[model samples]
Target: MNGRSPRWTVGGPDLDLADPHFYTDPRHHGIWRAARDAHPVAWTESARTGGFWSVTTHAEGSAVLRNPQVFVSGLGMRLGADPRGVEAAAGRMLVVSDGAAHRRLRSAHQSWFNGRAVAALLPVLRRQVDARLGELLARGGPFDAVAELAEWMPTWVLFEMMDIPGPDRDELAGIMARAFDDADESAAGAAGRTAAHTEIFAYFAGLLDDRRDCPGRDIVSSLATAEAHGRPFTDDEVLLNCDGLMNGGLETTPHAVSGALLALARRPDAWRLLKQDPGLLDTAVEEVLRWTSPALHAMRTAAEDTTLGGARIRRGDRVVVWLPSCNHDERVFPDPDAFEIGRRPNPHLGFGGGPHYCVGSTLARAEVRCLLEALLRHVKSIEVTGDAPRRPSNFLRGLQRLEVELVPEAGNGRGAGADGEEDVHVHEAHEHVRATGDAAGDAA
Candidate 1:
């Protein structure tokens, strides 16, 4: 306990962390700074929904996340999630389940994200990223990096891994965008979210059925054939988990990539530093994840009475761990606001901790690292031509659109991975990603 009383009262709009606008507005950074300084663990009251304990500091947020038995995720993991919907998916979904159920479910899909498994996908990932960078540079004008590059890379990798049919990929991607859309916490917004989920489930349900009779070498097939408690996963379990995996895979890395470009654009010196010393790609990617902290907050319900930061928490009280705040905690990372590429021992909770740590973290790191490598090998500089619009969602924080001019490296006719320099960095970066298993953040 910090011995300081929790900020029990919500005094103004700035303190209303539940509002999506708070995330989009630049002032939110200062707001989190103030909140963390005044009340590391504050009691927030929302009239529209309900009240929750906002865990803002790194120490307390990590403590809550690390102790899942006391703070269970089965009730809900996000602020605006519908209570009834959460109840229905409680034990079935991987993100919401706790205890033994969560372990078994995670084990079923763990093989896909292991270091060797993700390492196998590096060549394909590198090629795709390189090709995309080449195409964008050839156009020779300002382009929407979000629509063209940031969103494209992860979506492609996810679809390829899932083996979704070519024609169906576009439709599924659109539905997924809506499923995690930055909608408000209102009745209408809830309906829209539910509809998107229904569509995703229906699509995955068909895929699950197809995988049952003729299993393929993909995640869906593995889940369809996987056995837990000596029994196969039921249709509901498979469908719900598929929804969780897709949401996690698609929603996070794009924002990290977008945020990376935005961060570099704002600080050209960082980009120049990376170009000069490509070996820094490993730490640079970690810095991007820490700086972005795309998965803004994760919620958990108290399973038993507990005292957190000197505040009495009832069994049913909801506690939300603000990831960005934790990542930005001055106590943990010195000069936390500065995007220092060479930061060492960065213990950012961009990814939720404990049993619910992000399963796709390795793949996410690979994707970001590949993009940066492509940029270093081909693009000379990143210039932000227009205002980068941010996604308006309290749960997810990222740029919705980034208009940037990608200047091609001089005398480099070919796209990414064209020259020998790429090979050297790729080898080094690949070894780094495979070796550093502790890297964490975003999407759990």
Candidate 2:
């Protein structure tokens, strides 16, 4: 059950996990398998930003992620991150903070993402999935699902939840997209990223100020009015966390959705299983999250000297956990490469682990489940039409473009319920899904 295919040969010295190009190559998966087998906690030398240790196994990754005290996030959470920028974001941003500060910051946003809160959002999410998918199906032509369908629902939901003005959404989303662009690391790319961050900071600053005087139910207003560690969050703290929330909310779901669709197109059998048994939506959603592992890796710095997976460590050492690799670990998941919708005891860390586990996880699962539900009710079949280009980044494994034709169901008449209300099926399977506790992790 190691899932080690015959094609995966051991990578030689030229293998560099830090390179973005390394991920896009088809050989990357095999390389990871080879690395995991050879050295689960091997030290990787990166020409771009010195070197770091790569933790590839599920057990080791969970250990590092859960023990944030030892593998602190204050230094940086990704490769090649500027030290100055990481220092600035350390305590203010939830993703990079540690201990009490992390807990307090996470608390401010917890209520909004709790099960009850996510349940309230189900209607809105269903409507969004229906409207957008309805339009695409009506068009009756091949389309890039990434642009047309995958990206819209999550973007719309995040903006709506934040109460961001309709007019400003497109511009803000563009900026946010650019802010996290790891595809190109050239000088121009760096400049574009910096510019995007600047715009995002400014946008949130204005929103925070407005909410300070006149608060509302939106996240901004909550953060604006809330206090942490005996004092109200300063403008910088609110602004930083706002940036983090925006990134977290918008980044993970779309990639997961698109990846799910691509997986379905490739494995029609899985789609058929869902269509036959609508109750399988919960487990299918879990399978999607496990398969995608969108946030490729998350980094932490050693707070003090430590030993992990028999590797020697020192304080301030950088440790990167490859999430997708961990998800594919043979020890954790039997038949790791196979896409099994009915996978039980699936403890994949697609959402990450420990203190920084995704606050938006409940909402994330609901979003994916609703989309899949909509597809099952409406789409008859999915076929890949053209090239599906993956986003080139060392951090995110997302589709830049996914060209596919969605075949509509017969006699469904736009897939609306007979009563014309949202035709979502509520099943006991959700309890199991919730129990699995799989989540979409932080944007870092």
**TM-scores for the candidates:** 0.91, 0.91
**Error in Å for residue 328 of model 1:** 0.7
lDDT (tens digit, per residue) of candidate 1 on 34-90: 878788887787665578889889999999999998999999999978788899988
Question: Candidate 2's residue-wise lDDT over 14-41, tens digit each?
Answer: 7667788778776788878877888888
Candidate 1: which pairs clash?
A: 350-441, 350-442, 351-441, 351-442
Top model number, lDDT? 1
Off by over 4 Å in 2: 1-10, 413-444
Per-prediction tally of clashes = 4, 0
Model 2 RMSD in angstroms: 6.1
What lDDT does each candidate get?
0.83, 0.81
